[model samples]
Target: MLREVTAIRYVTPLREGGSLPGVVEADDLGTYVVKFRGAGQGPKALVAEVISGELARRLGLPVPDMAVVQLDPVVARAEPDEEVQELIKASAGANLGMDFLPGALGYDPVAHPVEAGLASRVLAFDAFVENVDRSWRNPNLLIWHNALWLIDHGATLYFHHNWPRAEAVVHRPYKWDDHVLKPYATALATEGPALAARLTPSLIREAVDLVPDEWLDDGGKDAYISHLTARAAEPEAWLP
Candidate 1:
């Protein structure tokens, strides 16, 4: 199933993606927004998405179908002319792709709000486990048909560096927690346990393998793979 995506056609540039997620039409007619790593952040950003997004899916969080796409030269240069081609080629390293959510709107943690009760608890569960991609500016939480979907989990397990930092640090996960998601607390709490239980080592490994080869360089490859493998082996323990 993973190998099928042999090409990626650049559709439009998504400026809000920070690293610039190009809307891509896959060979299977499925469309996705591909996010490439910018100058400062390394390819590990893409790796983070593979590891954490899959973990969230196992935890029963609403995550979209994700995969590693190979950007063919024809598709890569699919832009208007040669000038655009150079730009695409320049972003060769971390040119990771994501499944684009149609008619999706970004959720506002403040104007939109999340609950500290159940929704908050689930997000907290995400945090406790080191899934740090859920942000305030671009929550990356998509609203489709009144249902919330999560995308772009490129910043998770950050505490892997600060493993021995502290014991159970606490601050409200998000500022809007009390207003928006409070009502959904029961719903979040109900699904939280089942989600956490499903995160098996095999699942984690499968997710890690989904990352595109180009994203991982020589020195980074082994460390990236090892990091995820270790995280999968012990889900109950703190990241890193």
Candidate 2:
């Protein structure tokens, strides 16, 4: 399970995407970028964040430490914006938090060029989960201490949003034309398959197991397990 922490202060909003996740100080004396469960996409987005981010961590990728942040409505008093206050009240429970990188900068491809090995693995991982957010215009990536770190995976595993037709699109081809890292995935054909082969069912399950129960929409955990297990088993169909 991911570490659990209590948010003590509402620092400020990150304002990256529509969700408006914010920076918060936790009882652990650590700061984190908290993804509110009450945001527009609902708990499912948090679920994707935990499951996918954890998977990246397990794959020896550079990702921040994650925690389940328990929020209390009392903190809303510190927020003046009516909109932000509402968001705090709504997310008065468990929200996903990622350790904040103090000096990290938004990824600029020109500034931090990726090697073919790292690029191919990330591209393969994103393709496996059908993530459409890692584009050149909005690369969900960061550069901290001169190393690339993956972030904002809340857009992955979209099939969970539409269960009935999820199977139909399991083998869907990824639209890589706009993927920011596609240009560096020089060894995708070989690197992609090598990475896919390592995603055994047990490995995937380890990541999914971190999600809390209430965050799951009735039988959601089982659905995720089934879909991802199947997807991992058939990499030839989805790995770009």
Model 2 agreement with the true structure over 1-240: per-residue lDDT tens digits:
889999999999987667998999999999999999988889999999999999888887788999999999797586888888888889998999999999899998887789999999999999888889999899999999889999999999898888888888777877778899988989899989988888888988899999988799866677888889888888888887
lDDT of 1: 0.58
Across 87-203, the per-residue lDDT of candidate 1 in tens digits comes to 567565335556677898887655555443437445644643455555454456788877778776666655333334322222213333332343445554445444545556566
The estimated TM-scores of all candidates read 0.68, 0.97
- Which consecutive 10 residues in model 1 have the weakest lDDT in total? 166-175
The 0-to-1 C-alpha lDDT of every candidate, in the order given, reads 0.58, 0.89
Q: What is candidate 2's TM-score against the reference?
A: 0.97
- Which predicted model would earn the best TM-score? 2
User: How many angstroms is residue 46 displaced in model 2 relative to the true structure, after the best TM-score fit?
Assistant: 0.4
lDDT, candidate 1, at 43:
65
Clashes of each: 7, 0
